[model samples]
Target chain A: METKIKEIIKQVKKGDQSAFEDVVTFYQNKVYQICFRVIGNAHEAEDLAQETFIRAYVNIHSFDDKRKFSTWLYRIATNISIDRIRKKKPDYFLDAEVKGTDGLDMYSQLPAEQLLPEEEVESLELQSYIQQEIMQLPTKYRSVIALRFVDELSLAEISEILSIPVGTVKTRIHRGREALRKRLRRV
Target chain B: MSCNKQFINLMHKYLDGELTRTDENLLRSHLHSCQSCQKHFHELKRTTTLLKSSSELQPSSNFTEKVMASLPKEKKRVGYMRWFKAHPVITAAAIFFIFMFSSVFSAWDQDSQLSVSKDKNLIIQEDTVIVPEGVTVDGDLVVKNGNLKIDGSVNGNVVIINGEHLMASAGEISGEIEQVNQVFEWMWYHIKDITKNLFAFTNK
Candidate 1:
């Protein structure tokens, strides 16, 4: 699969533009998860992830083919998602890029229930707790933590994805972990 | 008892699995003795666990389709002949330098012979250039039409075009290694090389 992606990358670099769709499809889930984990939203993350691939497509020339392709893609995804967070209002997730109301919206189709089960409510609370805490983190720490936790990537890989020093990556993960500890202990 | 603030970073590193054996022992001793530190480490550990366990959001089924539809048209990569025809002066200079560098500096060997640009502290066995174990190569190494087996270390970028590169178990590379296994990759490699040279010249 890695070699195949490399070949596709070569083709894309050679101006076989249709080949980029394969790249997009191959990476969409991962790219979306990275954005979703960071931004804490489904719809905006999809937009940002789409924007990530599009940016990657347009700026593919800047990417060196030697390094891991996912590193470059993750870098683009991280930067785009963080930029959206920085530019918009602090709580953009509440009113963010929730695009068209496709009739197939999953939540709308679910049967209405008077209440979620107690365990479901507890898990939902924890989910919101986790989301709120993640959103509260500074962007630098947010991106690093998301990359670290979502993918369980090594600190070195995080360094490559963020283009920061490994030492810096370590420091951020340490600080980010400590920050989360301080916040979540309250819960 | 009271916890020293210094062991705070150690607690996080312990969770991250980055502690060296010695540091691990030290932190373990500290944790064994420190009550607050233990509680703090537990909280930190749980935070990461919960973060990992957080709900994952799935993209709409049409996500890839939407992204694919919205991409801007590719500028379209031009073939070398088209590029050369478009930039005649550059093409001429590039051709001149190609011959100049080939003949004067690192010439491509005819008859499918091996050509490696740097041989500083290199051991050659047939067509393979081996950076011996414990030896460090200080600069970029480009091998053409041959194989490179790095068992030691390279402090610079390694480019293998029309060749194979292998990393022995003990090998380490500080910079990236680019192995071009395809003809298209080879073309783009040269294009990038020529463009870099041209850009450097134009900047000057």
Candidate 2:
């Protein structure tokens, strides 16, 4: 898959429009998923996803081949998501820690175990519940959680995509998990 | 390390199987006796599991098509403006050279040829040359540093240097006619004459 994507990117660099369409097809879902998870809206996510590809197309020449193409695409998608979120909610702070109902930092909350069985029906409900709580996390924590868990990206990969240190990525993931655990415990 | 702090710090790494053998043993021993730490570990594990299990949202059916449609057209070739933008120094240099060449060429003196008239009616005064009526100059007529008054026919080219040529209603010039009256025009003419004479002497 990596080799295929690299070829597609090379073709795109050579001004092959059809190869660009292939790229858009390959990354559309993943990019849309990232945007949707970060922005938490279907319409806005679609718009941002489209905008991300548009930006990628326009600036495709700046892409470095030494790095993973997915990482580059994720960077564009995540930055666009962050920008759109910031634009929509001017009062939201990325650096500030989100607090739960107990007046403690959400990330500092204790982790909890799954109290229900592994029934498929209950699992779906739990999944939905977890996603809602994930959405409620602070923007920074939500982004890391989405990239870490939803996208199943490695900490180093997340670091590269977000342009942060690996230690910071691990810390954000830990905090994001704790926040979700605390929120789920209430339910 | 203290058991509680150690457990708290290593809980994530432990679930992720990133702990070393010694730390893993220590955490396991600690979890056996510590219910709070064990519960926290289970919860964190469950949280990550649920997060991983969440389904990725699929975009609309036409999502890729829409994205492709929205993409701006690829700039396949370097346009003149884009080349100019990229090579600003070269563009500026070219423009400067063109301007300089045009200015120099425009300022260069234009040469005027002279021929004396053999006609009897041609009158040459101190500062004015006049061709009276019913007279025809058979050769090229050139008036230098003076005005020319023509009332008859001239069979050759008529040129005036540092002066004006006034032609009456009945006057006729059979060849090309020109006037050079500017100060720079005179300088240009003298420079051109000197260069020609020098070239001719060099050839000789």
Candidate 3:
């Protein structure tokens, strides 16, 4: 399946618009999720997602076939978000490129019925609490946490995205979670 | 068999289904006895479940429409060559590299041509100066009444005032000076000769 995508990518690099669209359709959701996790917003994620595909289009010729297409795409998205964050002081998710009034904020109230069962609600509350605590973490920890959990990418994939070694990725995820658990304890 | 650090580590892998049987049994034994670890495990389980159950945000119903709208009119193929050439930075870099290469080669060709011309002039007036091979004249080679023949290369200028000059196969002159046959009476000839000889001797 991936080999087929690889072939499609080669065709896309040859200036095939249909192939490019295929690439976009294949990776849009994953790219959006990554942008959302990194930027912490939906609108930005959507915009960044589109931007990632545009960038991939621009630099497709430079894409080496030895690496996984997904890995390459993730690297592009991660870098774009990181660069955007460094240049701008963002109040919301970096992925939120689009400014929409209807978009949900992290603090928006959940409907009563939609809430977890009483015991589970406490856990959900604790998870949300943990997320809030995570937001207070340094960018390094926050990035690792979001990549590890929210994006659900492998440690190796996260390492590639961050341009760090796998060991560093592992350590970051470990320490980031530990920090979250510690913060949760305080609450 | 409690919520010790080891069990904590095990829980991380356990949640990911990475624990071996022995490690799994160890964690299970620890969990059975330890309330805190059990609670922590439950919390982890709950969190992951909640995360999974959380509603995902899809792009708007017209999301694909919006995306397609933002894109240019769909074409089956694009002229990549024109696109690549239109990139000012890349084009500038390429032009810069080409200019540098041409400049370097031009210098080399000029130097080689200059040497070839000088060597030819040395052969043309071979009656006056005998320049030995393997000697290089560092400056100009000029033959007038005096003969200059080279079996070796010269490292300095070669000038024959009213003489013939011969540059053998190994002879080379790299610098510049004047070659004149008609001795127009002037106060400058002696001074120029002194300066040229001084420079030539120093180079040797």
- Compare the candidates by TM-score and give the number of the best one: 2
Give the Cα lDDT of each candidate.
Answer: 0.77, 0.74, 0.61
Candidate 1 ranges with C-alpha deviation above 4 Å: A90-125, B74-204
Better of 1 and 3 by DockQ: 1
Model 2 docking grade: medium
Question: What tens-digit string does per-residue lDDT give for candidate 1 at B42-157?
Answer: 89888989888743556788877787788775443445654677789998898887885565233333436777888888889998889898898888888878889998898899
Model 3 lDDT per residue over A41-150, tens place: 56876888788877777778789998888888888887887776777765545323234632223323333123346534454454344444555444555566666665
Candidate ordering by lDDT (highest first): 1, 2, 3
How far out, in Å, is residue A172 in model 3?
2.3
Best by lDDT: 1
Residue range A1-187, candidate 2, lDDT tens digits: 8899899888887667678888888878788878777887778888988999988888888999888988888899999999877777854443344554322343333243333344234444544556656666677777787777656788889999999999888877776776677766554
Stretches of model 2 off by over 4 angstroms after superposition: A90-128, B1-3, B75-204
Candidate 1 has which clashing residue pairs, if any? none
lDDT of 2 by residue, B1-204 (tens): 234566777888865557899988888888899888788888878777777774647778898888877777655364466578779999999997688556645544343333333436778776677898888888777676667888888898877876678655469889978786776665566566567889999999
The number of the candidate with the highest DockQ is 2
Instruction: Give me the TM-scores for chain A across all models, comma-separated.
Output: 0.73, 0.79, 0.70
